[model samples]
Target: MELFFTSLLNGVTYGLLLFMLSSGLTLIFSMMGVLNFAHASFYMLGAYFGYVISSYVGFYPALLLAPLAVGAIGALIERYGMRRAHASGHLAELLFTFGLAFLIEEVVHLVWGKSPVPYRVPPSLDGPLFTLFSATFPTYKAFMMAVSVGMLAALYALLTRTRVGLLVQAALSKPDMVEALGHNVPRLFMLVFGGGVGLAALAGVIGGNAFVTEPGMAAAVGSIVFVVVVVGGLGSITGAFVASLAIGILQTFAVAVDYKLPFFDRVTVSQTAPVLPYLIMVLMLIARPRGLMGTRET
Candidate 1:
């Protein structure tokens, strides 16, 4: 029972991390109607950039600054590159992002080299938050959960309560209408895209130390990020939130087990282990195509 509670808590923590990544991806998709394939690259960049900042200053400042820098880069990409790519079509936008992802990874390798970098947990947060039933939960995980919740709340309030949030929401509903109203829709798009990338980067900064800060980390988490967004439903931040948490829980729980079927316990095999998420996603695509909490498409 204690172990179960521990895994459940761990699952929730992992889910928040997923939320941080998927929330940004969902927003970019909703605002731009173009999949930013390089979203995870920004995440990788955040980790690397945070490492640099951490070396110079401290983890606290690195946590705050790295994402802002990545946001700036994302804005540049949207303003110069994505705007041009948008003219060609959604396919072009996706291809552009894919190319951008490739380039970013290459740049990362160039700067950080091909080897994995060590991003250790901060000494301050390295210890356990508390021990329950002889199980110790790290303080950093609690800090991460707190940060994710804070970020999600900020995002929610911005989208629903603020004027810019309304504009972005309106923009999502009808970009042409928003533009016709004399709003700089393109700039709005760039801002949203930048904001989205920034959120992903923020997740990167925190998660890098918790997980591993490495070039390959992006590729490892990238597809799962997409799955979270897709499962959450396009154009729905609420859905994204729910999905991010759900995927995070699912992934964390999946790794916490060593199980066998009641009847098939004797016939154990590792081949069917890792593909559960894809299977579940496929089921979601088939059943709830728009995803839970998704609004009707315009």
Candidate 2:
């Protein structure tokens, strides 16, 4: 019972982290119809920016400034780089983002080198929040959960209750009509793209210290973000939320289990934890390509 309860908490924490990272990608895809391969790179940039900014001022300031910096960069990319690529077609845009990911990784190597930086959790949130059985949950993890939930709430309210959201949603399905109504559709795309990447950077600001701050961190989570997005359904924020928690809990419990499969005696459940999400993705594709709670077909 103790193990189950503890694992459940840890799993939810990890799942929420995944949601934070993937939500940005979901928003970008849903609003702009662009896959954004470089999305996780922005997340990596956020962590590094947070590290540098926090080193100079503090974590709280970095928490605010880092995402803003990343968001600006994203907007610029959309304006200068992606805007030009958009003229060619969706394939061009996809290729542009795919190459952009490599460029960002190389830039990281040039600036920060390959070594992991000292991006520790803030001293204020370094201790335990509460104990379950013999296990103690870290305050930082609780802070992460709070931030993730808060972000979800804020995003929900912004999209459903604001004029800006209505315009953005209008642009998504009827760009021409929105433009005919006198809104700058192109600028709207830039903002949506920027906002999406900004969300990714925000995740980095919080997650970098909780995990590690390294150039390779983007690659580590990039694939999983896609899996979550796809498993939850492409362009579905609610689906992403559900999938994030599900995958988070699934992987967390898998790590703690020791059972072996009937045929694969050599592999324990714990050993398969790394590939479980991908396996789920494959199974999901086979079973229901549209994804859980997803409105569009994959």
Task: Go through the candidates in order and give each one's C-alpha lDDT.
Answer: 0.84, 0.93
Could you estimate the TM-score for every candidate? 0.93, 0.98
lDDT value for candidate 1?
0.84
Model 2 vs. true fold: TM: 0.98
Top TM-score model: 2
lDDT tens string, model 2, 72-187? Answer: 99999999999999999999999999999999999999999999999999999999888888888899999999999888888778788999999998999999999999999999
RMSD of each: 2.1, 0.9
Ten-residue region with minimum lDDT total, candidate 1: 267-276
Instruction: Give the top-scoring candidate (lDDT).
Output: 2
